[model samples]
Target chain A: MMRRFPQIAPPLIALAILLVAWELGVRYGFLKPYQFPPVSRIASGFVELSTIGFPTGVSIWSHTLTTLVRVLLGYVGALALAIPLGVVIGSFQVLDKLTAPLVVFCRSVATLSLLPLVIVWFGAGELTKVFLIGYGCFWVMLSNVIAGVRYVDPVLVRAARTFGLHGGELFRRVVLPAALPRIFAGARMALGVGFMVIVGAEMIGTIEGLGALIMEARTFYRSEITIIGMLIIGVIGFAISAGLTALERLLLPWAGNLDAVRR
Target chain B: MLDHDNLARCALRRSEAPVAKRTTSPFLQFIAINSVGKTFAARTGSSISVLDCVDLTIAENEFVSFVGRSGCGKTTLLNIIAGLEDATQGQITIAGRPVTGPGQGQGVVFQQHALFPWLTAVDNVAFGFRKSGLNKTDRRQKAMDLLTLVGLEAAASKYPREMSGGMQQRVSIARALALDPQILLMDEPFGALDELTRIELQHELLRIWEAQRKTVVFVTHSINEALMLSDRIVLLAPNPGRIKRVFDVDLPRPRSRTEPRFNALYEEIWDELST
Candidate 1:
């Protein structure tokens, strides 16, 4: 803990200085109050968001929970579909080749660009937002899962073979475990994609998420609330990724330094 | 002291003699490499011959070494023997049964330690017992025994990346030995290690070989290493790799490098290799 003090102190100090400077700039009229809300206003915005609530009975906690639920649903749905499909596709050369162009085309189509089409299909509801998040997360997760399974080191496979491992036994014992680090990386990346897509999806229709809160705040000219919503999103993202990293460490104790495995 | 020149001449004469005439007992001919040749098709549509009509016989428990420079197809020959690769023109048989594919009682230790990165050292070793029908606890105990043999019992739970290069190779050796194979085929197993580690592994390997009494076919670029460990050294020359000469090392075990006979044999093999 003592050794980490020097490393941890600088970042905390930098953030404090920036916040103080921003507050002073707003108070001194150096920065426009409407454009950049002072530190005090943002702090009050936080308190008001939690206590008195935004718009009516919907508090910041509810908004955060709503966003979390949406992201998790979409992320989980994407993983459920992608993982088995990816493993099967990656195992066979012909399947991988056949789907390559289609996968690439779908990934390149842009998740938000399909917002109008999705809204037209499903209407401006929770399902529309969830579908958009799933679509965005699916492609990223699928590609990563496929690459993970496909590029398992040939040396490892040959080593397994010398012990009489072949076909499904090889796939289960060697290939699956070897592909895990990459698969976990895909999950983390897919979650990030889901998070990004949800914000945009929420902005179009719904006033119960951080994305909707910020968008509504902009229309009401409450820039402080908008800034608070943005900060909450950042905090949520950081917490989620950190949680995932911890989960990965817990599950894959043998996988040292996951970054090294990521292509 | 024996005359070095005379000894060299005698060795050359012995090598020149026909393979069938060299051995007296048919029972000792455990492995037969009958005119084994390998040809790989190049990307440009031409086939490149790697091994050309190579024939050698290994006894049941002989410690033989194939010493040659790079591109000499030493590793290729080892792979062929292991049944990891096929010889386009000929066949290799162990105990009179033809080698069709991998897992034919051949335990191979590669140049690079190929331990599964995700598995612990003990788990990696236990991977060899997949077909043994041993219970998990029994398999683990057996794996621990192999790890102990390789002097890596303390590192049983450690992952491959957690250990040093030498330690990883030790685990790899343990894993290969776990297969309980009839023959041990090593392709420059210690080639990646530092000099000290390499020497240490050489002694360890010798000790293991003495204990296990398994036939070993070791490939290396180092003549001194071959002199230290091998019962006989087979020299292979590059283009369409074929045996150039063979030397019988009759020196005593725990052989000293400074000894006159060891130096003489090293010099003789070095001379043959460079030419």
Candidate 2:
């Protein structure tokens, strides 16, 4: 514990020093409190949003929950469709060659650039937001899944052959396990893309998400509320990523150096 | 020590003995290679011969080693026997039937321990029994038995990466033995280990071979390794690989490197390799 204290102490101290300097700068009039928002104002803003509500009706929790639900629905839906489809496409050479150019072109188009088209097709509603998030996540995930299956170690395939394992048995026993670390890396990357897409996506139509809360606060000249909403979104993003990392570790105990496996 | 010259003469006389025909029973010729050849097509659209007209007969329960330098087709010949690779111009028969593909009861141990990284030692061994009709519990029990035979019962639950190279190789040997193959083909299985570990594994292999009495065809570049384990050593020469010579090692069991006769035979084989 004593040895680990040095490792953890430096980061905490740096963070504390940064927060103190920012607070002092605002309190002494060196910085505008309205624009920058002093720590005290942001703290009060957090309390007010949680209890007295943001727009006199919905609390900060409701906005955060709405944002989270949209992200989850899209993320899970994308993974559900992409994983099986990616596996099939990855396994067959004919299918992979057929779909390669299409997948690359689809992934290249900026996800947010599709916002207007999606809004026109599905209307400016929750479906548009979910569809945008799903679009951002699906291509990233599908490419990773395909690469994972395609690049299994040739030596491992030969090893399995010596055991009389071939075809489906070889794929199941050797290829799948060898490709898992890569697949997990793809999932993590897709989640990050989804998180970034959601924040931008929520700003367009909805007024009940964290993104909209901040946008609305800005229009009303409640800079402190905007600051609080931004902080909450950052925290939620961090939590989601950390949760996924923990889940990956728990599921694949054998997969080492997951970050190194990422392309 | 006896005179080196006398030992050389003795080894030469022993080499002339017809070891392959020692077994009188017709069924004893367990594996027969008849003019086996291998050719690979290059990207330039021309063929390169890897092995040419290789013929040999291995008796049942015999320990034979194929020794040569790189590109000698020793490993290729072993793969052909295992049915992992097809010979271009010849046929190999085991137990009166022609070779087809892997799973005809030929168990192979590669130079690197090829145990599945995701599986624990026991599960890797049990993989050999996947085609067997045993229940899961029974398969685990049998795998445990093979691990015990290889002196690794304690490491049954450990993953491949968690174990040392020697331990990993031991697990691989156990996995191969789990299949109870009629013929065991090992391609330099102990080549990567340190000298002490290699010698230890050689002893362990001899003990297991004595107990199970399975035919073994081992491939190695080490002359001493072949001399230590083989009843007969088939020397292959590269540059269009072909059998150069076959030596019948009539040395007694538990052969020592320090023995003058062993040294003499080693020098002769070393000379053969150089040429």
Candidate 3:
């Protein structure tokens, strides 16, 4: 099994070699340090910021933690609201048709486009950023969930009926479990939307997020800090996505391939 | 030939076997449709009668097959018996009571495998017990038992997608059995499989049926299949479908298609079917 699995090599070694070449290019002045900072410069920038802070006293951990908390709050709230509503809307063709145009229009109205309106309503505080992330995540999650329910194979429903399952029992036992793979896919997509929205939302009114940190570094000509913030954002995105994937595998162990379910 | 009065008496005595009690109730074990007919509205708003005044009685623990070509309303009749659709006229009864809606004694296996892809083989089998007053563990246990009955204990944890086509049909059969209805209704359950798999499943089905001894109403298009599996084969003709003839298959268990008697029955049914 170990031989078949290609157990000797990891992708990290190749990535390290590339990073070294990039750092050398910057050091030899083949590439400008400011436009494209090296790994050493980014690492030093991370250490300096974490110790002395990106702003005056707020550390790098504080910024990342703040962003994580806001996104979590909004994403969880959206899921709690969307799933039931999506099930109801998805199960009924009439309800889906009636809400189709409304859902489309709302999805098209970009979350950032509502930032000005949100500020007027909730002020330029934390509420505005959370609301923006919530707004973005909700529709993407809801649409995918509704589609998941609506598109379930009718053969499964017929099979369930033959078993004497109907009404709520039918929905919970058959419909919901059958729709789970797609719903999990929707959740993964929703998390992505929330992440993107939070970054954009935090760039303006707060210095306590990766987005704010990067923008602040650009203004102070600490380009190295900007690079570190981008890398941190990338790492966070990768980790969150992988976490959701593992969770999906755990919950729906019977799911096959998962190409359609994993966005 | 069986007399009408004798058939009626038989049906009336065993109509409630699967519905009222789990015990070996002699009162309700058969499926009887008395002068039942189905008519559906066409796209042009004209009504098309699918079945007309169809009357049949399948005895307790009998394997009855209904055979006809496509558009012959065989599947429609099975649906009516299953209570999936209401007959436009006449009465259809299972276990003595008129079928108004689904979920009584009718455990139906479709032409398609129809195993739930999301559930493992055992889980799909036991899904019928969802409303059967069984707890989670008990239902799963029953499901496992049914899968074993269908010779699928090894693949109990495998999903529908993971199993072969014949294996999927086996799971579907096991799933229908989980309902534990007095009557098992199959609408061309092996019609979708290849020649080899289909023949293998037919034998597997006979074995399972012999062990379970549930009254069965099977629909198929093939004359050989009907002659091979059924105790009585009901031949129906299209264009306002009605039963043309009912032949009692006297072949013993595991009857071969190459045997003289089997070939004679096949030719007999084929002639009746084609004409």
Candidate 4:
């Protein structure tokens, strides 16, 4: 406990010092409270958003849950479609070559840039937002899965072959397991992309998410509420990545240092 | 020294008491390699021959070792015998049938212990029984038995990553034996291990071979290892790899390096390798 204090102490002290300076600057009229909003105002904003609600009825909880639901839907949808397709593509050299250019082009196309076209097509509803997030995640996931499958240890295939395992049996038993660490790396990356896309996605034409709450607070001069919303988004993103790391650890006890293996 | 006197007597008795089929040679050739060759395409577009016109015969239940320098195609020859790689020009026959592909009663242990990381030691061993039609429980039980045979029963539930290098190689040996193959092809199975572990595993391997009575073709760069384990050692020369010589190790079991005969043979092989 005593040893850990040194590790934890520096960051806390720095944050405290920063907050005090901000409060002093605001009180001395050197800084504007409306823009930066002192720490105390942000704390009160958190309480107000949690209790009396942000847009007269919907609480911060509802906004967070809505954002989370959108991300989960997009992320899960992308993984479900990408993994199988990627495996097939990665297995065959002919197919991989044929699709390589298309995949690269699609991944290079910025997902948010398609928002205007998507809103025109899908009418700026939940589907439009979810589609944008899915589009962002799918390409990242697909490419990683393909790479993972393509680069399994050749010695493992030879060993499997010696045991009368060939064709699809070899792929399922040997290739898939060997590729799993890379696949997990891909999943973690895809989730991050999904999280980033959702925040930007929810900012436009969506009133029931953290992104929209912050945007609405900005127009109403509630800068403190906006800051609170941004903090909540950051916390949620941290939680999401932590949860994914935990899941990866749980599923792959045998896979030591997957990050080290990944490029 | 091992109890070789009794073993020699037993072999003599078995040969004398053998039934009807009479042959000029006392023991039948288990694996016959006839003018085998291998060539690979070079990056410069010219073809490079790795093995050229190699020929040899191994008797049933005999332990043979292929000793050679790097690039000598000893591994390639072993792979051909295991049916993992096809010979460029010649044919190999096992049990009177021509080799085509993997799965002709040939169990191979590579230099690297290629046990699947995801599976426990038992499961990796049981991988040999996947197509044998045994249910999961029976496979696990049989795998446990093989692990016991390799003296790794305590590590049956451990993953490959969790085990030491020597232990992992033991698991690899157990996994190969799970097939109940008539011939075991080992490609320098102890090459990556330290000296002590290599010697220990060498002893363990000899014990297993004695009990199983299977035809073993072991490939190694170590002359001492070849002398210690093999009934015959075939020396291979590189640069279009071909057989340079074949030495018969007629010395008694568990032969000592201090013995004059052992030192003489080692010197001869070392001189041959140096040239």
Candidate 5:
């Protein structure tokens, strides 16, 4: 049924209707200026944040770039540590048993819960924010990597062994490739964790990232800027996920979209 | 360490012996009851016998098949042959030396294709040659050659999902043959394909087999398939699994289901299998 209609038309019309309703509600005094800001006001706010800048000097682009850098740095650090370590734990049953409880406890602990402790240790610097982001991303990635390596089908390993593949050869050829789809899922999840942590971390002590922009705008009653900041954050999150999906497609061409290698 | 050359000479001498004829004439010869058996510990701390006093010799370049229902220890026997599982009771000697574990010219093809999804058809085949003495350029060329032999040259660069079920299994066969093993142990490699694709591949496999002439011990439930492929079929019955019957298929190459002899043997085996 949907195929018969113009593909983009329905969604476009729905979005237009929503914007009109929102704009009219504010103008007619049915909705307040603070909680639910008008679309027109948010549009002006986008322009203001880009040119006039938010919090006096830094523009929206600078804040987005800063946020992006923090997420990337933290995410990369977490993966670098987690992937190898997870492979070690996952490959060995004794090690998996030994660390199972520790991993479970760590993952259950809230990432934001570490914020105060991190600030105390690192003195509220960029290092503290990065550490929190890494901590959150690390656990998520470690678990996924462990799951990836552990869940390799037994048949493939048997097939590999018959071909003179044993020790490192078996692990590299059969286990690693077999576990790739799951490992790719872990990387994607870790990035998301890093993004979420950065937002919460940036809100605390930083004045240069998007989260900070929203906090600053809220205090000054420029709530339209706060709304704009949230939209930008959402857009960035969506783009990052979509980018990772494309990367998965390019790297793991055989993967089905079955979420079998779940995050 | 008397010497590997001396051992090879002894293996050649023993391989020429008469007892090797009853089993098979495959290059990778395995002789059994003089070999050994396997035992498994039950969950209740008791032990169960998987294979007991079981010994069979295979000749060079023979086509053999093992047929049985699930839990009939057919797969366990195959696993033992592949050296994936150790025997608890007896000893197995390949070419006069005791079987230790996997990796002495044994290549495997599985029921599920088991082709690495991330790899293209050519790359998956090449994975078998990773440990080969050949260099990178030669290994790749050899893999491509094998793919061509399997008639998947047109789809050589395609991933497993991009190919048909039959094509993937053909790629799997090519992957197995890439190692140039003396024996190929297949665990229902074509069982998952549809009827049409499966029959087409059966002919394709026959062509490849004629050229390669490797020892093949296939496992399957399809009576016609076993008759069509095997020079000898070993049937096992469950409940403390053991060999039930062995049928020699002497019908001509490229066998037919409609053939009187083919149907007769199928009926005989089917009766034994059901009974």
Candidate 6:
């Protein structure tokens, strides 16, 4: 940790400078407090949200947990369906060609644009939010998984075949492991999609997430609380991606740097 | 402290014994490539002939090399011999049995090492024993033995990416040998390495060949490499690839590049290749 001080110090100094500048701007007549929300107010707002609770009973922890659970459910559901379907589609050239246009069309449709239809189908409730998040995540994850399986190095397959491996045995031993780095890349991308979809999904017919908290606080003219909620969402997003990167490192030490694999 | 010259002489005598055996039974061909040819159909509807009517017969436990320039179909011929690809015309047989497809006792080491990046060195070698009916522990032990043979016992647990290019090739050789096949097919196995590493691996391969005598069919672009390792060097020509000439290298074992005979053979092969 001590050896990393040089690398860590610059980012810390920059963040401190930015916060101080923002705080001073609000203190003077340079920036409006309602729009910018002074650092001190946001900090105090964070403390109140955690302890005194937002809208009487729901704390910041409850809001964060609700958002996390919703994201996890949709993300997991999307992956569960996407992976197997992607593998089957990727393995057969005929299937891949047949579904290419359909997949592209579905993935192109905006997630939030389907809000009215989803609300009609599932009613504006928890089910509707989950369905929307799943929809956004599924197509991205599915496409990535298909590409992963399809683009496995031909040399690797040839080497395996020389060992007499073929059919399911070849797929299990060589193709699947070769495609893992790509699959993990897809999972990370899908999670980002799921997170983005949930925030928008939570804003509608829900008063129990960080997104809902921001929307509710803005209506009550608590700009500080809104800023605080936004900061929390950023923190959650950063933490989740970092956690995923760590998990990828632990699981796939042989994959080398994932940044090279991410396309 | 060791008598290096005497050891070389002993190795030379052993190597020469095969030549005498070959003369006695010239009809006993181990691997017979009968009019083998390969052609690829291009996107423009024109068929590209890579190899044409190539005929060569390798004796059992003999070291033969196919040497030529790029587009000479040396690797194409090796792939056909390895059963990874089929010939457009003709056929290849091992010990009188026609090769239908890959994996009938033919082990190949590719130029790129082709070691599965996900598996460690030991596991990669053990993969060759998938059909051996051996338990996991036994297979691992056998893999370790092969690694030791290639002087890479310490790198048994290392992944392919963790090892150097030379070390990866050593692991690849170990994996190929783990199959304990009747013949070993190598396509420029050390072609990507530096000159010094390539020379060192050439010696290492010779040592392995002496220890485990198998019919070795090696493909290389280097005439010097072919001269250094093979008993007979089959020079191939490109543009509808065909054999130009076959040179018998009767040099002694532990052969030096500085030797007059070695230089002469190199010049002869070079002269043939230039035309």
Query: Once superposed on the true structure, which residue ranges of model 3 sit more than 4 Å away at CA?
Result: A1-21, A27-30, A257-259, B1-30, B34-36, B47-55, B116-123, B130-145, B154-162, B236-248, B268-275
> Deviation in angstroms for A84 in model 2?
0.6
Q: Is the docking of candidate 4 incorrect, acceptable, medium or high quality?
A: medium
What is candidate 1's lDDT per residue for B1-275, written digit by digit as tens?
23355345435544675422345355677888766777889999999989876778889999999998898899999999988888876678888888988888999898999999888999999988878899999999999999999999999999998999899999999999988999999999999999999999999999999999999999998888999999999999888887777788999899899999999999898897898
Candidate 3 chain A: minimum summed lDDT over ten consecutive residues — where? Answer: A4-13
Error of 6 at B270 (Å): 1.7
What would the per-residue lDDT of candidate 2 be over residues A157-224, giving only the tens digit for each residue?
Answer: 77678777898989988988887877888888898888888867887878888878888898988999
Q: Which DockQ values do the candidates obtain, in the order shown?
A: 0.65, 0.44, 0.43, 0.62, 0.58, 0.59
Candidate 1's residue-wise lDDT over A1-263, tens digit each?
99999999999999999999999999998999889998899998899999988977899999999999998899999999999999999999899999989998998888999999999999999999999999999998899889889999998988998999999999999899988888899988888888888778998879899889998899989999999988888888888888888888889988877766432
- Chain A of candidate 2 gets a TM-score of 0.93
Ten residues in a row with the worst lDDT in model 6 chain A?
A254-263
Query: For every model in order, what is the iRMS?
Result: 1.0, 1.6, 1.7, 1.0, 1.6, 1.1
How close is chain B to the truth by TM-score, in each candidate? Answer: 0.91, 0.91, 0.87, 0.90, 0.87, 0.90
lDDT of 3 by residue, B4-33 (tens): 554464345335221111233435336766
Candidate ranking under lDDT, highest first, comes to 1, 4, 6, 2, 3, 5
Q: What's the C-alpha lDDT at position A37 in model 4?
A: 97
Model 2, range B27-137, lDDT digits (tens) per residue? 766898866778999899999989876768898999999999899899999999998899887778898788999888898899988888888999999998887878999
TM-score (0 to 1) for chain A, all models? 0.95, 0.93, 0.92, 0.94, 0.94, 0.94
- What is the C-alpha lDDT profile of model 4 across B1-275, one tens digit per residue? 12344345434543554312323352565787766778999999999989876767788999999999999999999999999998877678897788998889999999999999999999999998887899999999999999999899999889898899999999999999988999999999999999999999999999999999999999998999999999989999898887777888888988787889988999988998889
Q: Identify the runs in model 4 with alpha carbons over 4 angstroms from their true place.
A: A1-6, A29-31, A220-223, A259-263, B1-26
For A162-196, candidate 5 gives per-residue lDDT tens digits of 77778887898779888888888888878778777
Sorted into a CAPRI-style docking class, model 3 comes out as acceptable
Q: TM-score: which is higher, 3 or 5?
A: 5
| Backbone clashes in model 2 | 0
lDDT string, candidate 4, A108-220, tens digits: 99899998999999998999989998999999999999998998888899999988889888999999988888888888888878877876788788789988888889889
Off by over 4 Å in 5: A1-5, A254-263, B1-36
- Find the candidate with the highest TM-score and give its number: 1
TM-score of 5: 0.89
What lDDT score goes with residue A14 in model 5? 100
